[model samples]
Target chain A: MDKKKRIVIQSIATLLQNANLKGFFTGKIYTGQSKGVCVPGLNCYSCPGAIGACPLGSLQNALSAYKFKLPYYVVGLLLFFGTLLGRLICGFLCPFGFLQDLLHRIPFPVKLKHFRLDKYLRYLKYILLVVLVIVLPICVKMTPFFCKYLCPSGTLAGILLSFRNSALFQAYGKLFTWKVIVLAVILVAGVMIARPFCKYLCPLGAIYGPLNKVSLYRMECDASKCISCGKCSAVCEMCVDPTKDANSAECIRCLQCVHECPTKALRAGIKSKPETSKPSHEGEKVPEGRMRGKD
Target chain B: MRRIGTIICFGISFLLIALGILDHQFQAVLAKAAKVCLECIGIG
Candidate 1:
């Protein structure tokens, strides 16, 4: 998107606060506080000032409480965002993702791709999303299983809200210790990898990924007019191999494809006919200091 | 087909939840089936 359009969307995101949701995130009780512009992403449901239920948490609750599936408001919201903005939310909206990006920029000078554990741990998020967020809630009669057990968001939120409600603090026990351990691990991992949670465990990513193929917003590759020079893939923070497939489930639709394409061959939400051109598979040299903005 | 599948799967989940809500028996059946499946896999 152009600069003016980008500014407008960002201002909307910044200005649109679900006040009730914010209050909810700030408090311990669910007052059904339903106000605020819910930024579509994997946010902490229990976050003080979180107006909407974390989609993952809601999914877990729906599974455990009713012993069946519940309404998927979270998925709908996420798809809406994915349709409208793609992974621009990661760059511009999600507070957690934003935090991770900021931490990575912390000048401590850490090498990201150098560690095997960093690469391998990405899959753990997927496993966590499936097993902790989905399966355990269904099987164990637990509400917000991932939040209760594994979420760093929960730990952060708990630290803030528990101060206001002493009863909540008093309620902390061995399970809390376990959650703390998980939080410590997650924190360490976050410091190491760019987005350990999103890469490995975010079910929201799993959902958003499939939608990228069909969403109004997308990261698209022109198969016909393309050289497979991996310039697009080289600079991608999400580690998407844009040349192999631009809209792969692994891709967050960040539009690095569009920005990095030296030939200007990539785009968002393809509607144009494929040009009758040769397929070039040689990885091209990626340019530096790239930026692409979207709503 | 995928949309239909999503709807069907979601519908079944609601049915299970509705049944479970109305009857602990259904919950028992669900929990039982799940536990048994898990145990069979040595997950317990």
Candidate 2:
């Protein structure tokens, strides 16, 4: 998909998920029947306009109540989404991902595509998934650690809701301040980097990342048509080489590489077999910086 | 094989979602989501 089409899809998805317009004016969360179901992206349930539950938030909350029973509904919904679309949700649905995309579009002096720490930092989201989203919630009863402490979407919701609710504003403490700082840092980093949060911090992205390889909606590279022109890699902000690994976990299915491929080697769809030609740089250790799109 | 994997995943997810509903898990989610979610908003 082109940038404009993707942006439109993102906007529509965001609007549909948060369709409770009256709640925004009233400063109240939607308590409708739809709230029981989970949205495919990283939308916060506490947001005044949210009509559905957030998958990660529901998972953490369910884990907190683990002794009672497993969170089958939330886990099943997550698996359903992962198997169906993988990080395609991150690519075209997530409000926060859209926000990051918009922020990255702001004209900036320096755009850091890759740094020395990039590879190591990519593992942080997985660590957070295992720790904050699962372990801590199970250990501490009824505490959704990720939502309370780390979720910028939740923080954003709090900020938006507090604007109309004086009581909520009065309840702010150091935790809120800390969350605001985290949000500020992430937003600023997003301006310099394409998707710093999705790359290094989002637990939801971590969950969907590995599923990209097996998801029904997947990327296929036709080796028979490849010219090894390296245009796909140059255009990928996520630092994935579509020719080398079309269904890479790091790919969010942005389709920029597919659109940019001069030879039309890369295509994305459901149930297509991916074929990769030998990379020109095969058998040689590529420098980390160069491999990850360093300028 | 990939198609089989996808079908199996779909089957499992549907079964799990059904079982969750039977277990009244949907009600739990609804109840929690209906509230202000103070912790989520960083108010509690």
Candidate 3:
């Protein structure tokens, strides 16, 4: 998809998930039936306008309640989303991701495309997923650590609701201040780097990242069409080499690489058949060809 | 094989969701979500 189309889809998904307009005016959260259902994106349930639950938040909550029962609902829903669309949800549905995308669009003097620490930093999200989201909640006194301490989307919801509810503003304490600082830093980093949070911090992204390889919707690179011009890697903000690993865990399925491929070798969609390779003769050596490019 | 894998994943997900609902986990999710998540908003 093109940038405009992705933006439009992101906008619609964000708005639809937070469709409780009356709650925004009343400074109250939606308490309807739909609140039980999880949206595919990371929208906070506490948001005054939110009509659906956040999968990450719900998962943490369920994990916290592990003494009572397992988090079957949240886990199942997350698996359902991951197997179906993978990080497509991050690219086209997450409100916070959309916010980051918008922030990255703001003209900056220095856009940090890549840094030496970047590869190492990418593992942080997985650590957070295993620790804060899953382990801590189950081990501790059922505390949703990530939501309580680090979710910028939750912090944004609190800030937005506090605008209309003076009581919520008055209730703000050291924790709120710390959360605000975190949000500010993420937003500022987002202006300098494309999707810093998604790349390095989002637990939801971590969950979906590995699933990209096996998701029903996936990216495929046709070696026959590839000219190894390196256009796809050059355009990928996520630093993924599409020709080398079309279904890399790092890919958000933004489709920019697909659009930028000179040979139209990269494609994204549901695949019906398993990948087939041509047979090679016994003891025969194949010539090296520029079918795939280096990262 | 890829198609089968996708189908198996879908089947497992749906089955899990169904089991969760049967176990009344949906009600638990609904009750929690309906309330103001104090921790989420950094209130407590």
Give one clash count per candidate, in the order shown: 22, 0, 0
- Write one digit per residue (lDDT tens) for candidate 1, span A80-163: 565555556655555565556545555555747446675676566677778877788788874556666666665766666676
User: Which residue pairs in model 3 clash with each other?
Assistant: none
Model 2 chain A: weakest 10-residue lDDT segment is A286-295
Candidate 2 lDDT tens digits, A89-156: 99999999999999999999999998999999999999999999999999998999989988999999
Which of the CAPRI classes, incorrect, acceptable, medium or high, describes model 3? medium
Worst ten in a row by lDDT for model 3 chain A? A286-295
Model 2 misplaced stretches (Cα beyond 4 Å): A271-295
As for DockQ, the candidate ahead, 1 or 2, is 2
Ranking by DockQ: 3, 2, 1
Fraction of the true interface contacts (Cα pairs closer than 8 Å across chains) found in each model? 0.00, 0.65, 0.69
The Cα local distance difference test for each model comes to 0.54, 0.87, 0.86
* Tens digits of lDDT, candidate 3, A186-273: 9999999999999999999999998786798888876766667899888898999988888788999999998887767788887433
Q: Score the docking of each candidate (DockQ).
A: 0.05, 0.53, 0.59
- Model 3 alpha-carbon drift over 4 Å, by segment: A272-295
**How does candidate 3 fare on TM-score?**
0.93
On the 0 to 100 scale, the lDDT of residue A228 in model 3 is 78
Isolated chain B TM-score per model: 0.52, 0.91, 0.91
Candidate 1 DockQ, CA atoms:
0.05
